[model samples]
Target: MTDLRVGIGSLKLKNPVMTASGTAGYGAELAEFFDPSLLGALVMKGISLEPWQGNPPPRITETPCGMINSIGLQNVGLEMFLREKLPFARQWDVPVIANILGTSADEYVRLAAELDGAGVEGIELNVSCPNIKKGGISFGRDMAVFARLVGAVRKTVKSAALIVKLTPDAPVAEFARAAEESGADAVSLINSIPAMAIDVNTRRPLVKNVIGGLSGPAVKPIAVRMVYQASRAVRVPVIGMGGITEGRDAVEFMLAGAHAVAVGTAIFSDPMAPLKILDGIRAYMENHGIKRVSAITGSVRT
Candidate 1:
């Protein structure tokens, strides 16, 4: 057997395969399919200081080789998640990672502080959400704004590891370095490329938000390039995601310097995609005579 375990700061994973937040829900629904603990880590959907109803109807649209979604960070409020969901997640042996977002720096601080010591392995800051306080600008698009948000959360949270999830709209390496400078433990990248789709007959957009985050195989190559760049730019671990539906794809990400990989849109097609990816990774390692999964991270030959 091959060694599949890896670490992100103080958080350890049985393997480098994790489920993307918002795709796997809070882990209850996925628990019905398999043991949620079997995954390296279970990243829950994005949570906020308050409940979000999300965008209007037609929030998701299927595109070629991928899909676009404008879920608008809809999730149960933090208090309710602590009251109801955290207990259930504690039952599993896997580490639970909270995916959090906020419209303001204060809100982000409050959310991180609440999740601190809340039995979670870490917190992934979903920076793709629009900052309503700043005239509807994305927090991740600006390096200064991104660093400020991360710094606020860093001061508030003491126990859980901080993982900043970056948007593809900006240079990911710059954002990753900014997160590190602000005390982030690790960074996850290629959240989703901003994109849009339209209906020719009505001459209107298919998605209600008009523009949404795109994810799937279409973004995999771009994700790989970003992961490689960001990993080189920072000493922290990089969790790569975007269109990873097979084991070979996951291995490609690791080669690009991702310490771990997350499955997002692929789950919409196959609930057991993460497990399949894990199995494939193990097989690839065995075939290549590789022992530790970490050995391949950033081993890409240019």
Candidate 2:
């Protein structure tokens, strides 16, 4: 058997494969396709301080080689997740990571502390939400704002390993280093690129939101470049994600210095995508005489 285990700060994974938040729903629905425990970790959908109904209809549209979605971070409030969602995930042996977003810094801190206290193995901050008090600037887009939030959340989250999901709107290296300095144990990158699709006939936007995050194979190279830049900038682990669809795609990220990789938009097309990608990775390892998965990280030749 291959030694696929890897560690992200204090969190350990049986393999380097995880479910990207938002794509995997919660743990329960995932079981219908494959065993949830088989994954390195289950990153549940993003949760907020309050229940958000999300955007209006026609919130998603397919683009060439990818898709754009303006789902608007809709999720069950933190209360229900604690009451019903977390318990079901705890049933599995795999680690559970919570993807959290909030309108204000205090809300982020509280969400981190609550989920950390509730025994989540990891907490991934989704900092793409606009900061209401900060004149609508995204927390991840402003250096000082991003650092302050991460630093504050770090103070309260004592148990769970902190992971910041970096927004592509900022300089990759600087933001990633800031997260590491602010006490983030790891960083994940290339959260869907901002994009739009237009219906030329009607002269209208395909998605009602006018613009949405573009995800899928279209963003892989950018993801790889960012991951490469980030991993070199910070000593902490870097989790690379963008347009990973096959085993080779995951392999590219791993080579680009991602300690682990997450499957996102690919899940919409193939429910078995993660497992299949894992199999592909295993085959690549065996063929290359690589005895351990960790050996693939950062071994890319210049």
- For TM-score, the strongest prediction is 2
Backbone clashes under 3 angstroms, per model = 1, 0
Residue lDDT tens for model 1, 65-176: 9999988888998988999988889989998999998888888888898898675889999887778888878899988888999998999889898999989899888999
The models' CA-based lDDT, in order, is 0.92, 0.94
Clashing pairs in 1: 216-243
The 10-residue segment of model 1 with minimum total lDDT is 112-121
Error of 2 at 111 (Å): 0.4
lDDT of 2 by residue, 1-302 (tens): 78899999999999999999999988888789899899999999999989999999699999989999999999999999999999988888899999999999999999998999999999999999989999888899999999999999999999999999999989999999999999999999989899999999999999999999999998888889999999999999999999899999999999999999999999999999999999989999999999999999999999
* lDDT at 36, model 1: 89
Model 1 local distance difference test score: 0.92
Candidate 1, after superposition: displacement of residue 295 in Å?
0.8
Show model 1 residue runs off by greater than 4 Å.
none
The alpha-carbon lDDT assigned to residue 85 of candidate 2 equals 95
